[model samples]
Target: MASGNVSSVTEFILLGLTEQPELQLPLFFIFLGVYVITMLGNLGLLILIGLNPHLHTPMYFFLFNLSFVDLCYSSAITPRMLISFVKENVISYGECMTQLYFFCFFVIDECYLLTAMAIDRYVAICKPLLYRVTMSNQMCFMLIMGTYMMGSSGAIAHTVCMLRLTFCDGNIIDHFMCDGPPLFQLSCTSTNVNKVVVFTIVGINVLVSSVTIFISYTSIISTILQISSTKGRSKAFSTCSFHIIAVSLFFGSAAFMYLKPSSTGSVNQDKVSTVFYTIMGPMMNPFIYSLRNKDVHVALHKALKKRMFF
Candidate 1:
């Protein structure tokens, strides 16, 4: 029954964040601005990383990919969401699934990419002598490949499970996007197995990535403590502090959206959480990295100067 299942509902109406008549226009403009900034920020970062020879290290390599993922991640959800703020927000089944798959793919990619960055930091600080050996160009390429592999596998599994279920519960999604939980709730068929598998995979992605980051930071802190110069310690901590902030913001929203019990949070709260991770996360990341990183700032200044002269 699961394998042969076909959707009875061909489209879904997204209820959006607020049903109030007055709030719709304001919200649409706000998210449109967000989407615009997200595009500029990520694109600018990508250009900065690509053009600068000094930034061609393992850390910037990860940041480059991170910016790219954030670009795709926001693009996958924000435009459709902005549309919902202004109109009836109808999405066909195929479009919904496509959005969901890309959303899941980029999100999972970010999770493991952050984990890989943490490992890079760990090696950079804890084993400075072996940093080059440990995170070589080939090694970095492989880690990035592994991140995408995980992302593809995770998204495929979730989308496949959703594909096997038929939706029949009035076709109104109470959230702004085509997320897994709302779709699961809309399914008329038994979703016991789907829920179990989906939740299990979510747990694995969040837990494994977070735990790896924690352990890496723990070792990094320990290493930083042993450094004799306070200046050196503070410099090391500053680099890590920004990454920590970005990780916290992203994972904090993710936890609220996915890990909590369904009975505890309102649909509106879920909408807000989804907005943060999907829109705000991407928009804020470029600022977080570029503002905090001296290397990025210097590269941007140089790029600006060259363009100014040319």
Candidate 2:
């Protein structure tokens, strides 16, 4: 029906999570609360890390960046996603592209950062005597730089590939965001290259990161078992468990979202996975780490005491 393609397209309409009127309001409030907590939790961790001298180790350094990434990751998508809940989610081409770029950026960034943290944990657990040397200031800086670089490259790749597509059909994105699958579905042009690039890049990332995590955790478990005392082994397991949970949640949802068969009757399932990684993942990270970490608890109490005294 429409002859003009993405070139002539000025805007796109985002069909929110569902069309049901009854579900819309409830979903809005739920995600609103989630976003609020995401902000507070992540921002609080960032500030706490900055203030607490005790948390200035390689472990906390990774966490500081993790918090920062989660904050940005949540911010990049949540605000725009929230708009879909209340009103017409009409996003300009530029805005949509921008959102897509940053969304890809943050997600990819989190992937590598989590891998880096796993390595950090590996060094801490498996090679504690050399932890300082292995995860030095310079090394941490480099790892972080590489993490962001990958994010930038992945985002650029996806966005550039997407830009090449010609959208002549209804410019309506079925999901809340400008995700790859829905956008590819709307293209009048062939998306073979896009598919190859998508799977190649995402698969490489997931494979490498997940393999690294698996190896690190396996070694960590072995090392913990070698501990002589029950308390020592228990403590080691306790410390690593939080990171394991975060990794499983993030990577599991991400795999479900990206690696699934792109067939009919699967849009809702994809959206659910997307929402889990994009919405719930970031929100859960800060809580997962802080709630279990004694250092964060001590730091919070000390900060509160200082505030009370002042």
Highest lDDT scorer: 1
lDDT of 1 at 213: 98
lDDT scores of the candidates, listed in order: 0.91, 0.90
Worst 10 residues of 1 by lDDT: 1-10
What are the per-residue Cα lDDT tens digits for candidate 1 across 90-128?
Answer: 999999999889999999999999899999999999999
Tell me the spans in candidate 1 whose CA falls farther than 4 Å from its real position: 1-7
Per-model root-mean-square deviation over C-alphas: 2.5, 1.6
User: Candidate 2 — which residues are off by over 4 angstroms?
Assistant: 1-7
For candidate 2, give the lDDT of residue 66.
92
Residue clash pairs of candidate 2? none
